[model samples]
Target: MITRILLAVDDSPAAMASARHAIELAACLGARLHVVTVVPDHSLSNLVTRMGSHPGVHERRDQAAEAILDHVVRLARASEVEADAHLLEGDAARRILAEARSMHADLIVVGRSEGLDRSTTAHILEFAGQPVLVVPPEVR
Candidate 1:
């Protein structure tokens, strides 16, 4: 009965893999896809320019999120699924969880990168306590 599925994606290879998997699943289940991307509230450019590294951190993060969101929307359209996209700023896992709840998603899909960040991603899956699909980076 997973009519609504949320995909928590970044621009990583693993995330892209998960997005593709989510597309296939959505098509199979006749589900709607809710694609969301989160950017950390910090910008390298602002950090270097302002020296304060405070202003526009959120802004830059939001911009990155928007780009990822747009990518997801395009993916959905190509896949021929009813889909929508969201851009948010904050911790990736937190924003993803929030978006899933707000969208009333029946399931969530995330990607696991092949680096030190993998443990952090694992922690997200453990902490979220919701059904999550973890796509490996090599799956693509």
Candidate 2:
């Protein structure tokens, strides 16, 4: 009885594969899909600035997040799933957990990283109270 599903995605190819799976699953189960993209907080980015990237980097990140969410939501809808998108600002894992709790999601779906880039998925699996599905990367 999956009523709500939360999917976390980024610009990575793995995330795109995860998004596709989520959309199909949501449509199959008649569940509402909630897509989210978390951008780094401006203050945090400022503190961790390296190579003089300058301030307000989060603004560009926000725009990118919005675009990602928009694309995901559109795909979900096309798959015949009721869907919504969210653009969050903060630590990626933290924001995802918060959204899951707030939305009362029955499950959380994320992309499986190939090597050492799965921090967010690791954090979610460690801290989330709900079930999680880690979609594998698409084979090329």
List TM-score per model, in order: 0.82, 0.88
By summed lDDT, the worst window of 10 consecutive residues in model 1 runs over: 40-49
Candidate 2 lDDT by residue in tens digits, 32-91: 999998877677667656547566666667788899999999898888899999888888
TM-score of candidate 2 against the unseen true structure: 0.88
Q: What is the C-alpha lDDT of each candidate?
A: 0.80, 0.89
Error of 1 at 119 (Å): 4.1
User: Deviation in angstroms for 31 in model 2?
Assistant: 0.3
lDDT of 1 by residue, 60-113 (tens): 667777888888878888889899987776677777777777777789998887
Task: Tell how far residue 134 is off in model 1, in angstroms.
Answer: 0.2
Candidate 2 residue spans exceeding 4 A from truth: 44-56, 114-116
Global Cα RMSD, each model: 3.0, 2.2
